[model samples]
Target: MSTTLANQQRSKIISLLSPAYLWLTVAIFLPLSAMLYFSFLSDVPFGQTEWHLTTENYQAFFQTTTYAKLLWKSIKLGLIVTGFAVLVGFPCAYVLAKVIQGRAREALFLLVILPFWSNSLVRIFSWAIVLRGNGVLEIGLNAILPFEVDVNLMFSTPAIVIGLVHSYLPYVILTSYLALQAIDDNLIDAARSMGAGKHTILWRIILPLSLPGLLAGAVLIFVPVVGSFMEPRILGGRVGTYFGTVIEDQFVAVFNWPLGAALSFILLAVVLVILALSSPILRRAQT
Candidate 1:
């Protein structure tokens, strides 16, 4: 009877998880498998297009230095955006989680997430309007200061960074807030009672405790930023060509789906390797 009951419980657990597993298989795995298959093909096997299984798509990446440089550039962009997001978002999160309270906290929290309420395109264009030469930012700066200012950040790397950061900063703030919320106030009090300075406590206790959330936010920001084409294309102009834009061109402009798939898989592999290398730190943080 006990053995039968255990079997029934296992069956119930599997039943509960079946729908989610089915959705993942259909949505994620199936598309990834299709892409993987496409990456090994000479061309898209549709309509009158004659195609064959080939490794040239993958080989092309290693054969060209241009792809490597663009990929590295994208990786750098990801790191920069993630670093800025964490630096800015963490303080905002700390204030929200540990300092503020009641209605004021709610109001501020809403403001932090206010960007999400509007379309991203609107936000990027708004920044463009502000950052353009003789635009709001320059004019406003000139109005307040004695010195004349000329600010034109649009169509530049900084503009891309700003837009990406604005778009993704909330992820860092939200995750960091959740992690910071879990930290006990008593521990802080205990540290204070033991004569720990603000810096000491922050470095020795708070930072270590909140690392998982930081890493989680970093991953969330880094992964998307690396593959982002739209923001860079709009904000960066000629300077914005990265691995993502190259992949986009391969699909949209060049109609080279197999090459795009190969590039996409290479990006996936790079991301997986990064995650694997960092998993030990993530596990340590959770413990």
Candidate 2:
């Protein structure tokens, strides 16, 4: 009877998890597997297209320095955006989670997440309108200042960074807010009672305790930013060519699916290696 109950509980657990497992296999694993296979082929195995297994796609990456430089550029862009998001978001999160009271907190929290309410394309274009030469930002600034200053940031790296930071800043805020909220107030009070300074409390207590969430937010921002093409293409214009844009061109413009797949896999490998290397540090921070 005991054995039968254990078996029934195990079956129930499996049943509950089966749908999630199925979805992962169908939505994630299947596509990844297909892409991996495609990466090894000389051409896509569609219609009358002749194709065979080849390593040239992967070889092309190592053969050319252009892809490496673009990948590094994308990585740099990801780091810059993540850094700005953390620097800006953490303070806003701290104010919201620790300082604010009553309805003010709720209002500010709503504002923090306001970016999510609008379409990303709309937001990019809106920034473009403000940042373009002689546009809203330039006009407004020139009006305020004694001298005229050129303030065109559109179609530049700065524009890409600004747009990306605006888009992903909320992730850091939301995650850090949750982490900060979880810390007991008594712990902070106790530190104060022990004669800890404000900077000391923040550095030793609040920051350390909330680091996992910060790291989580950083990873969330970094990963998608690295692979992003649309924002760069629209915001950076002629200067927007990154690893992601290159891969996109291969697939969309050049119609080279196999090469695109190879580039995609290389990017995936790099991201995974980075995560694996940093995960130990993140885990250590939690302790």
Candidate 3:
């Protein structure tokens, strides 16, 4: 009787979870497995083409310094973009969560995330027009100032960073707003009644509870930015050749599928390591 009951419970659990597990297998695990399998091959598997297992694809990354340098450049870009997003989005989130209320907060929230509804490619191209020499930004600055200004941000690293910040800023704002809003008003009031100053309250009570969300948003921003190529290509031009662009070249222009797969696997490993390192702190904060 006990065994039968246990078996029935197991079957019920599997029935509930089967659909999601099946979707994960079909959508994610299979593709990743295929990529890993292909990464070990010497050549692409096509009709009449000879292919064999080899580790040269990964070795290319180690033998040459270029890949490492480009990867470092990408990581640096992620950090810079994440920093800018946090700095610019935090105050907006605070206002939305604490300062504003009622219908005004809802409207402001909608306005803050309005850019997310637009096509990302369109937005990047629009920035290109605005950042070009003698463009809107240049014209505006020159019009206001006595001295003529040349704003040639186009085809530069800063341009890429700006586009990325514009694209991902809302993630931080949304995450931080959720975190800040979850705090109890009475806790803040008690802090105030206990003679805690504004800075002290913010530093001690607010920042601690909200840190988890900030980290979550930062992780979200950093991970995709590390893998980004399109925005950098469109905005950074000559300076856009980072790790992701190199991987893109391997798959698109170079047609080295195995090498690209290997590079992608390496990047996945790096991202996993970053998340693993941060998970402890995030877990502690949540607790």
How accurate locally, in lDDT, is each candidate?
Answer: 0.93, 0.95, 0.93
* Model 1 per-residue lDDT at 173: 96
Give the alpha carbon lDDT tens digit for every residue of 1-287 in model 3.
99999999999999999999999999999999999999999999988899999999999999989999999999999999999999999888988998999999989989889889999999999999899998889999999999987899999999999999999999999999999999998999999999999999988998888887888889989999998998899999999989999999999998899999999999989889978997887788766
Q: Candidate 2 — which residues are off by over 4 angstroms? A: none
Give the root-mean-square deviation of each candidate in angstroms. 1.7, 1.5, 2.4
TM-score to native of every candidate shown: 0.94, 0.95, 0.91
Candidate 1's C-alpha runs over 4 A off are: 281-287
Q: After superposition, how far is residue 237 of candidate 1 from its true place, in Å?
A: 1.0
Scanning candidate 2 in windows of ten residues, the lowest lDDT window is 278-287
TM-score of 2: 0.95
lDDT value for model 3? 0.93
Query: Considering every candidate listed, which one attains the maximal lDDT?
Result: 2
Backbone clashes (count) for model 1: 0
lDDT by residue for model 1 (1-287), tens: 99999999999999999999999999999999999999999988889999999999999999989999999999999999999999999999999999999999999999989999999899989888887888899999999999987789989999999999999999999999999999999999999999999999998888888888878899999999999998898899989899999999999998999999999999989988988997987887767
Residue ranges of candidate 3 with Cα displaced over 4 Å: 1-17, 281-287
Collision pairs in model 3: none
Worst 10 residues of 3 by lDDT: 278-287
